[model samples]
Target: MKRPQTVRSRGQRAGLDLDQIVETAQSFEVEDLTMQSLAKAMQVDRKALNYYVKDREALLTILAHKAFADEFSPDAIRAAEDWRDASRIYASSFVERALSLGKLSEHLWFGEPLTTWSLEANESLFARFFEAGFTDEAATRLVTMLSTLCLGHARDVIQATGSMEKPRPKALRAALERLNPEKFANLLRILDHGYDTYGDEQIDFSIDVFLVGAEAVLKRDLRR
Candidate 1:
């Protein structure tokens, strides 16, 4: 049963703040969200939504930025054992949150006029690098490195999962299967299982391997 729509007067909407707008927007899927739908959901005129967001692209930019920012807690980050642990936590948070967004995660690297997802907004992450003895230059670079790794690998995981439903390369496997059906079958079976087994583990692998590589870079610099 559909409930009755609650229409508010112009005066009521005049008090509409970004927080209310953002909160209401969260109820929508990244694809189905629009000024008209958002307005309907809020039972306001579509112009009210457009007043807050000029267009769907602008709305997504704001929503994505807010979603990313809402994923972290400075206290949780501070509770890590060390910088590596902190990186792991942050990376996991980033990957998990981005994956939850499905298509919207791709906007992590994008920004527009009023976008607010900036490194300075999440200073806890940067402060972790500084506390771990990295110079300002290295710390900033590591932040970029982790962000790139998480975003790239998250995209990989998404593509791999989608490819699971796609046709497998049976022709390539057929030749291998003729020689050793057992090994080739096992090698390709992970994809048949939906390529989901290592999705979470892959995030950890990226962070751990990244930390090790970053440590080596620091040591190499010390020898300079």
Candidate 2:
């Protein structure tokens, strides 16, 4: 077997631009991507990709950073009218982006390399909460709660829709019908009304509930 020549520069190689690899990987579900596969798509040998990315983990980390930075941009949060608005915008955007990434959402949420950057971005958003009269403790707790809510909702959306693809209405209805009504009365009732899909409405509801609760707590604390 002949050895493949390494591309020395970060310019275009085999139709793959070094700069576009991360964005290209974002087009596929995280689990579906690998250096070998991506290189194949780029019409380059896998070794050629090494010139740009060291390995799969590094590639994934880059994608995670891009996704997080885009959604959690400090400027976007700063432009919000208030802490509540900032929280709403951040949570909604984060959930939607994560959901779009499918299995890759796990890497973004739990990956260790991105932790410092995540915390720094979140801290910027937390400052908005503090500026809105929330004590440090209150602001931290509220931001933590909102993050948990958004992550949980994103996970639910992934599982419900089966990997960011469109919902299989027939398959979903069949699964719901298989559950015993006696044990899952509420679920059955929900399915009966054709509310088989979890979507933006659920995300909005969770955010609204959290914001309302946070407001009540802040008001009570102010009164004390």
Candidate 3:
């Protein structure tokens, strides 16, 4: 009887592809993810990883871009009822997507030559803003400010809560207790209803405040 040829395992050697490496790497927590760690996960020698990706920087860049492209809708801005509503939708969606990445959010850098999906979303936003009477420069600044705010806010939340949903502030509450009641009375008062901490609601609060200021600016420009 003729026997079938022995098959080799995909993880047994350097017979690997970039997509395979990236897909496997995505399963690991960002902090624990490294070239060596990924290699270990694949059951291949670490050098095998280098053959596919030049180094860790190249690999991480690919990962960061992939994460953004996968999570965000390129037409999200166009789905809103109005230009102002678009800002709210985009800002809130951006923050939520970043938050969902957990510690991986820290590596979410948009390098030069942005992805097509990213550019598509920004283009929609710009068109919406222009139609709403904003100059190119004004629209650019508005988008930049809103995006910066969302990224910074998401980073702060991730650092404090480590992406824990509904995180309890046991440590923070205890630390607040140690402060002198006279000097920190107001701070302690928040502990009664629970510590006043970052949450998803801030996204709306920030966007609303931003829109108020933007409306003022637009009205002032029109009066000129």
Candidate 4:
């Protein structure tokens, strides 16, 4: 049997080799990722860093790609039994991965024009939905919805926690208490148990709603 050839990534081919840079950058807060700081950490001249990344925006794009690539694998989606399963896996994996990244998640949330690998990975994932009977337009919309849901949740969690590693129950309770009890009664009641306690529940609720709507759309499309 012949062995398959291994393909090198663009960074490796160009001597840009961004793995070290990405790893180092992830350790710092998103606000602190200036080119000079990254170059200093990498032991390269600031000007030389441009040889690999071109600019801060490019570096951020590469970092976003690295983070997503670590969490999402094309083969995993391919191995799923159905489009629904693939989407659930994608959303869950993406949210978990983004959360785990700490401050690094900001790049994934804000970066535009994702790297080639990231784009290709997303295309493959969405293509599975199309193959599963959804029209091209429907698949595109569904993908957008799912991605937005996950990213939005991640952003909310980040804001809620601020620089803290976890949500502070005391702080949340105090904030809720400060609101007018009569007008915000429902809001306070919902968060009485603490906002952090509902993270998993909220994620489940959002995913359930999305999947339900998606199924309805798919059924309607099929009937036409």
Candidate 5:
């Protein structure tokens, strides 16, 4: 495999350049890498790297964009045509991807500085949800809730149990099953009638509840 070299000639001379730094950062990530080690491997002076990037934070953002841009698979999410269905697919796919990447996923998604590209992708996903009849506020809240739930659950499962490789698809399927519209309606019924539910006593389930409530609210307003 030909290792891609960062362009370092002619038009740019910003001390190893952003491309080289980003490429080096990505290579480091692939090799279970670190920034200190990246500096060593790239053979660029630390001061030069400091001059090129603000700090490790900048380097990490570049690496995350590269990783997501190159490696993230949207096959699962793309299969669902409806916005609600797509949200389920997206959550599961993201969790699976995070599990595959292990610590790298955490570093990419949660580590500091953050990637604008990843943030924009998230914003776009929620925007799609809004376009599909959900209000902007509802869409944002729902996306935030689901993202936190799924990503945190994935991190817990993978990091603590070391079960990173998409543990029996059924696992994620079961989680998504909770978000079915009918099931959601049932929860609303329980809440309306003042009944308590058992198991998974966390805010993770709140998104499903909120989705149901939001849909009902929208329908009511539209009818009025």
Candidate 6:
């Protein structure tokens, strides 16, 4: 009786392993990179790759979480002390990483599992909020507000400058000076009331104001 030869696992097939897989996924082109291409790079059969990862979406989700964990894990921001410094560090680091990724973030935001991974990985943002002076409800709202601002501004910054740059203190201060928190709070209240209608330009303008207010509050609290 002739027995079939056993196929090696992806780890055995590729000298490079799961760590390599994660890194390869991050470094690979978000556009052209595919399951077949990843399988080739991994030196594994596509079917075998499918066994390890369900689909291209699954692979990207894994990669996104890995990349995010690598970038913003708690230890990564430990030097920032409590929530205030932590939040600023988060903003700066996120923008820096997003700038480095550029178009890849756009792909991830538009993609399935990747988008889920990105949003899920941001739970830490709320954790940081709680550590700061926010109650659970406030923390949730703050995290949502900050996430929208940060991600939207990140896209805008990349588009405007062709890359992400360090947020300028002077520039931030200048923008913050004109912010009307009462108006911004009212807008948020409107949003909470189920208003799905706002122009992108208005949202962006409001967010810029929010970011300034957030930073200002952080500074005041931390200084006290």
Query: By lDDT, who's the top model here?
Result: 3
Q: Can you tell me which runs of candidate 4 are displaced by over 4 Å? A: 1-33, 41-44, 51-58, 158-179, 193-198
> What tens-digit string does per-residue lDDT give for candidate 2 at 88-155?
87797677767776666666655355465556557668888888788888887888788888888787
Model 4 C-alpha lDDT per residue in residues 1-224, reported as the tens digit of each score? 99998886554544555567778877766678889998778776676665567888777767766776665667777777888788878888778767776566666753354555566547777878888799989988888888888877876686667444345555656776777678877776766644453387888888888989999999999999
- By summed lDDT, the worst window of 10 consecutive residues in model 6 runs over 162-171
Per-residue CA lDDT of candidate 5, range 1-224, in tens?
Answer: 99998776332443477777776666554555555676787775566667666666566656655565454445544455766667666665556555676565555554444444455446556656766766766676667677777667666665556443334343544555677656566545544463222113422364466567657856764675
Predicted candidate 1 versus true structure: per-residue lDDT over 32-102, tens digit per residue:
88888887887777776665677787777787777766754566677878887788888887777667667
lDDT tens per residue, model 6, 105-130: 55334334444445533566666666
Q: Which ten residues in a row have the lowest lDDT in candidate 1?
A: 164-173
What Cα-based lDDT does every candidate model obtain?
A: 0.70, 0.73, 0.76, 0.73, 0.58, 0.58
TM-score of 4: 0.71
Off by over 4 Å in 5: 1-14, 29-34, 73-79, 109-114, 119-124, 163-217, 220-224
Which has the greatest TM-score? 4
Per-model TM values vs. the true structure: 0.68, 0.63, 0.69, 0.71, 0.59, 0.53
Stretch of 10 with least lDDT, candidate 2:
161-170
CA lDDT of 202 in candidate 6? Answer: 41
Which scores greater on lDDT, model 1 or model 6?
A: 1
lDDT value, residue 81 of candidate 1:
87
Candidate 2 residue pairs in backbone clash: none
- Sort all candidates by TM-score, best to worst: 4, 3, 1, 2, 5, 6
Model 3 residue pairs with clashes: none
Each prediction's number of clashing residue pairs:
0, 0, 0, 0, 0, 0
Alpha carbon lDDT at 118, candidate 4: 60
RMSD of each: 8.8, 7.2, 7.6, 8.1, 11.9, 11.3
Residue 85 of model 4: what lDDT? 81
Mark the regions of model 1 whose C-alpha exceeds 4 Å error after superposition.
Answer: 1-13, 43-51, 110-121, 162-198, 221-224
Candidate 6 lDDT (Cα, 0 to 1): 0.58
- Supply candidate 4's per-residue lDDT for 49: 65
How far does residue 117 in candidate 1 sit from its true spot (Å)? 5.7
